[model samples]
Target chain A: MGAAGIGGGTVNLYSWLSQFFGDPDRRHGPDSIVHRVGEHLLFSGEALGWALLLAVPLGLLLGYTGKAAGLVTALSGAARALPTLGLVTLAVLLAGVGDTAVLVPLVALAAPVLLVAACEGVRSTDPDLRDAARGIGLTHRQVLWQVCIPWALPALLAGLRTAAVQVIATATVASYVGLGGLGSYVVGGLATRDFAQTIGGALLVVLLAVATQLLFALLIRYALPAGLRRARD
Target chain B: MIRFDGAAKRHPDGTLAVEGLDLTVPAGRTTVLVGPSGCGKTTILRMVNRMVEPTAGRVLLDGTDVAQLDAAKLRRGIGYVIQQAGLFPHRRVIDNVATVPYLLGWDRKRARTRASELLELVGLPPETARRYPFQLSGGQQQRVGVARALAADPPLLLMDEPFSAVDPVVRSGLQDELLRLQAELNKTVLFVTHDIEEAVRLGDQIVVLREHGRIAQVADPATLLAAPADEQVAAFLGRDRGLRGLALRPAEGIVLLAANTPLDGWTLAVDQEGRPTGWQRSAETIRQVAVFRPGLDTLRTALDSAVLSPARVAVAVDHAGRVIGLAPRAAVLDALDAAGPDTAAGITATGVADGR
Candidate 1:
């Protein structure tokens, strides 16, 4: 699709909004909105799950042992410097344009945030608390789980939300290769010059990102310890 | 008993944090390591808990090598109190106290029950049990720290300048509480402090350390004040050794003059509650009355009150804060002389005994 075709196409922002959100039969009629948003949710959720499983524990471990903390910092810096679009495209080329290619880059993109957050959570725990925990007879493992991780929860939860949103926003590129996600709308709309569909899909991703942020806020609010849950004046 | 057999610490940078030394900390008594900053007093105290591992020799608790025990298990068996109390900010005061019990697998209800009991034991208001550590004052937080340390009822407690961070007024109050608690609990307390007054006040035996953890003196407070090992030890004890020494002697020896008798033309004025209000002369209230309890207060306090009075007499008060009698400065001096030579060792040997 050429830029001229996109420019010449009628871009009815209201029509796109009606079809994507307001109108029932034409949009919510077949529940395609649900289908597409679910697919987007599934992809980001998968990426977040993988990041949590792989990165959070390692980050926390590095925090507890502290020997690998510098390594986590360096790796987070290196990962942030990664060119996301280039990485996804290169991954598609190397891994033959499938989930292998797509998932790898997504995990790489998301894991670092969670990793760094966990590291900081562990590192920033009050020194006195650590001493007290140990002095009070908690084993190293108990100290991490009962004291350190719980204390670091606020940071880790924030990291989780951040990685989830980033994953959702970036997943739009995946449909470039014919994947089933909200990205498919943008790719499919542009190919046929369906400007409304393209704009609709982009807006949906933004909505999902905003929703994900709120979801995380809720999670953090509930996950925090009782004493900390109350907002300070 | 805690025994240190040539225990020493040489850091990775080749700094001798504490030199090898042999020492025994008797059970059921407070053994204080007091000295100037950088004298390695802290290092010596940490060594008992294996926080600072000794490079040579070993530390034994009740004849078992501390190094052989798992660090966490060993630490759990010991109560460790630091400066500032170190209460967990994220936890409620009760939960903070219940920390060790929770780790020991006490059920929530059991742990919390014990925790509330301890909050009361530490003199915290019952309402403070559910509050966070930050909501409490520095003095209250310190009391919580003590409660937390005693939670698992560890027979030994290691306090590193635990009272030094508070105002002198609160610091002494906390010291008094610790002594009162010790009288009842009788845990073997290893307290660290740079203040000689604190050492003389709270320690049954004071280990005065010089640079490199060198033992300048190892004696009871009286013995230590009466006879420092050398000039360095005496210097570290500070210039007011005479006044500080009186801190170790109880006020019991001084004869108390009946409150009805006026001294040097000055009379004790009493409030409606019978508490000493001040010293009144024929004309007006000349000074606020400084009173010391004969059995409960130290000789230093008795002498202090007498010296501070315009008529040079200290009033004695009962537990109710009512005026009981007066102690003349001459009588205080006579009591000291009767105890023996002003040497701490002499007074201590003469059985002017005290314990924290």
Candidate 2:
């Protein structure tokens, strides 16, 4: 289903670009593809920056304190269940249609993934290790920061990777609110019945997913402890 | 010196973990609290460091009420070791050993340096200090736990069944190490154990607790084994108190051997001066007699000599006498059999003189 969606979206994307270049003559050019790719890149970068800045502290707080956890979980679950279009509309209503519309919902979607991951990670740490820390006379805060946080790093990072990929894939929905991403070409192509533009946009999304996954894999490989890596392996 | 005065611990649900208890752990000596499970031996141990507070009365350390001390600060000043070592898996052995020192605000380098020294003191090589707790075996981990407790050189040490988690062989080794450490350091120690044999072996003073946390009796190991305060204490010490008491008795003063006796198997030959010269075999009996001195043989040695000798008699002799008493195989058997299945009051002080 995902492969076919990407193919259809990519075809529509190419056809929509051909019209903008004023080419009734059926010919392919790199310029249109390049321009769309650049737009996709710019949109992803902004979305990623917002996702990280908002998600990290929220994740840390939810992970460490465990207070107000049920409320945070419920709100995150509700946000996640909402349709992408509904979120964009809500964001547009709240902040007016633009980048903020896209940014707000993207952060909302990513925060919960990160927060839940961080909380579970901290909770799952060995109780024996915690007791040992207390036995050794570490303060509660010292135990949290020095022992629990570092121990939970691998799980927290895995959550961040999930949030990053989800944000990239969902960034296409931002186009419906007129934020102008690779999704713009798909939406415009669908309106004008342009197969190439849709196919091209869908292809860009697939490539973005694969590339982001590989990048995060490399990051996790370098970042996680050998013991955690072996455990997962 | 540590004293428990009317100390009682009542849990939230009204279960009395420890009842009104009065005891003193003498300075520079080991006092072992031993009892069956649920007898509150461990609870009593934790109260000394304020890990478990007494609901009534107070625990005093050197005459100062423990409740008045800052819990963390007080704990830092007292060494506490629990069963299973309770070592931090993430920490290297040295860092674990240095825990108390680190808590007391010693510089990292100095604490670590002291930790390395303690590792050696506990008979672990310096290389072991770099490894994590999980990397070590159970025995090694317990040793590290002990080393960690001693790092701050605290005048008081509390151990809660520290060797109970290890196998018997390892437990014996650890017990010996503890004795050696105590001999050199002379720190006031309160050690808790469920094993009566362990209590007999390690305790200079043994405090036996009955069910519901009441003190059954408190006395030196020999006295406790000899004269249990009641049937409860006697039963806790087990039916083999005599054999156990033999283990506690030193070979020095108890055994008596003949002077100018015929050379025999497993016999210690001594000079007229009553110093040991050599051991003789029964098969190689000689016309000349050899004096065997006291203070050099144990009940086990005397038994071995009686068994291997053709005459079937081992003599007990002092410096002046040719032989004070003859320990025939039947006589040794009679003494052991006479001690059978009963708590013999005053047995510890009766037979053997206190030796240096």
Candidate 3:
């Protein structure tokens, strides 16, 4: 199913490129290619930056404090289960349909996954290590910060990667709510019955997802401790 | 200078971990609390640092009650070592050792410097300072635990089966280190173990507790071995009490005589100063050597000397380390034979015979 979808989208992208640039009969123009690539880059960067800033602390907090975890998890679950279109509509109503509307729900959808992953990571830390920390005269706060957090960093970062990918794909849905994301071409193509434009937007979303995943994978490669990374290697 | 007076502890569930107890642990010596599991030996050690509070009475350090001191502050002043070594896995060995000193507010540089010094003191190399606890072997981890406990140089050290988790060879190594430390530092120490042999080897004073937290006996190792307070105490000390008793026998004034001249083939001869002597071909061939100090050597030594000798005779000697007369094996046997069939009486007399 995934391959067929990409195949169908690729056909649309070819038609759109031919038509928008005045056909293969004329020479290809540099400006349209640059415009498309720039737009993709800008949207991906914004979504990634927001996901990291919001998800890391949310994950840490949910993982560390038992009292707040259940409620935070439920809220994340609720946000995740909401239909993409419905969330974008709600975001539009709340934030008046711009970058704010697109970024808000994207973060909301991503936070819960990262948060749950982080909590499990921290929870699974060896009990012996914790006892040893206490026995060595580390205050509770020190143990949490210096021992627990650093030990859980790899798992937490993997969670962030997952959230980042989800945000990238879901951010394109913002175009449907008048946010002018890569999704705009797809929605406009459907309105005008232009298969080329629709396919081009769909292809862009897939490429964006793959590129973001690669970026985060590389980030984790360098960012996590050598011991943790070696486990993967 | 640690004392447990009328100390009692009952768990919330009503299990009596310890019952009314009074113990005075002399400073500068090792006092061992030994008993079966659930006998409160560990509870007693914990109470010294308020790890387990006494339900009924006070645990006093020097003269002040431990209860009045803040728990954490009290712990910082008392070095506590547990069976598993309880080393922090994330921290390097040096940082683990520096824990108490760091908590007591020493600067980081000073604390780490002292930690390295203590690692060497415990017979670990300076290279060990950079390794984490998990990176080290069990014995090394235990040594680090001991170094950590000794970091603050506390006057009182509490060890709760600290060497019990290691292999026998490692345990012996640790025991020797502890002995050396006690000799040099002269810290008041409370040591707890379930192994009676360990108690006999390490204790200056041994307090044996029975199951269910009752004191079976409290005496010096020699007295405890030679004359246990009751059958339970005897049973707890195990079947090897007689063998253990040998280690407690005082060597002071036990006879040693110099051979006056070489003699051929004879097991009995006379040494210089007119003292009768027993001679063997070599020191290795002599199973026992009896000391005769004029007016001081006990009958027990005289008897033991005769019994252990291959020649079956003990030489009585003057204070000048010269032989005087011979106590034949038969005479020693007669004294033993005359002591009656009462074994307890024989032992009690042995203690008295040694001038109490």
Best by DockQ: 1
lDDT of 1 by residue, B1-356 (tens): 88889998999999898888778888999988898999998888888887878999899999999999988778878999999687776789998999888877899999999999989988988999989877888999999999999998999999999998899999999998999899999999999999988988898888878899887778887777767778888888778777777877788778888886877788887889988877777787765677788878888898999989887888889989998888788998888887777566334343122221
Model 2 backbone overlap count = 35
* Ten-residue stretch with the least lDDT total in model 1 chain B: B347-356
Q: Please report, as a residue range, the 10-residue window in candidate 1 chain A with the lowest summed lDDT.
A: A1-10
Q: What ranges in model 1 sit over 4 Å off?
A: A1-12, A19-31, A94-98, A226-233, B256-258, B262-265, B271-274, B344-356
Q: What is candidate 3's TM-score for chain B alone?
A: 0.73
**CAPRI verdict (incorrect, acceptable, medium, high) for model 2:** incorrect
Write model 2 residue lDDT over B1-356, tens digit each, in one string: 98889999999999999988888788888988899999999889988887788999899999999999877677777777888777765567888898888778899999999999999999998899888776788999999999988999999898989999999999999999999999999998999999999998898888888876787787777777777878878888898786566554433433233444553335656567654444467565333333234455444555655665555675666656445644556665555555444443324432111211
Q: Could you arrange the candidates by DockQ from highest to lowest? A: 1, 2, 3
**Candidate 3 docking classification:** incorrect
Give the backbone clash total of model 1.
2
Worst 10 residues of 2 chain A by lDDT: A1-10
> Across residues A1-233, which tens digit of lDDT does each residue of candidate 2 receive?
11223344646445544544444322344335565556666766776677667766666666666676777667778878967778889988898978888877777778778777777777766775565456555667777876777667888888878887888888888778776667876786676666456655776777887888898889888866444454334
lDDT of 3 at B138: 89
Q: Comparing 1 and 3 by DockQ, which wins?
A: 1
> What are the per-residue Cα lDDT tens digits for candidate 3 across B35-89?
9888888888878877688999888898999999877677778788888877665
Best by TM-score: 1
